[model samples]
Target: MTIRRTVKRVIDGDTFEVARKIQGTNRIRIAGLNAPDSNQKGYSEAKNRLRRLISSKQVTIVPVGRSYNRLVA
Candidate 1:
């Protein structure tokens, strides 16, 4: 399913938060890839780049499923 919402936060390089009209907010993870963690050398750059790309913008999410609670898109 495709969902349209405003990106509220970037949790990391491949994960972010989205706020929806009725559903409140949900954390989402990009599928089929991995990025450096916060303690890793490239983490800051990766996250910063991702944040610049999507911060405060409306985005579409196509969820594949859930990992714990986060939607994998």
Candidate 2:
């Protein structure tokens, strides 16, 4: 399912939440970018950039348990 909403918050460099209810959820985490814990460089910026890419827009998620296994977008 695809949901439409704006970014409500940015957490770290790999997590963010959307505004309102989106398919009954709001969190979105990109799989490709991995960091060495919270102290990793550009961790926060990476997440912020991702938030900009997806926030307040329609997104279609093809859920994958091993989301980090692939490199497609």
Candidate 3:
């Protein structure tokens, strides 16, 4: 099973950085819901929604590989 982590920051609707005291930085990108760029339409809203959805909460995280820092929710 994947380890659950507390959200540290919301990078976007599809991604957020997880805070941990490991040797390196860790970030997670949502599996689905490819949000547009910050300048794209509904970008802010989508990002906001994502933030609100997971802010200050714990979630499960399963790392796929080092090739990509993205993690599917």
Q: Point out the higher-scoring one by TM-score: 1 or 2.
A: 1
lDDT of 1: 0.92
Pairs in clash, predicted candidate 2:
6-56
What's the lDDT for all of these models? Answer: 0.92, 0.55, 0.76
Which 10-residue window in model 1 sums to the lowest lDDT?
18-27
Compared with the true structure, the alpha-carbon lDDT of candidate 3 equals: 0.76
Task: Check candidate 3 and list the clashing pairs.
Answer: none
| Predicted candidate 3, C-alpha RMSD | 2.3
Candidate ranking (lDDT, best to worst): 1, 3, 2
Q: What tens digits encode model 1's per-residue C-alpha lDDT throughout 1-73?
A: 7999899999999999999688778999999869999998899998999999999999988889899689999
- Candidate 2 lDDT by residue in tens digits, 1-73: 3444565666656656556563534555656755444677776677667667766666555433333332122
Candidates 1 and 3: which is better by TM-score? 1
All candidates: TM-score: 0.91, 0.50, 0.78
Candidate 2's TM-score: 0.50
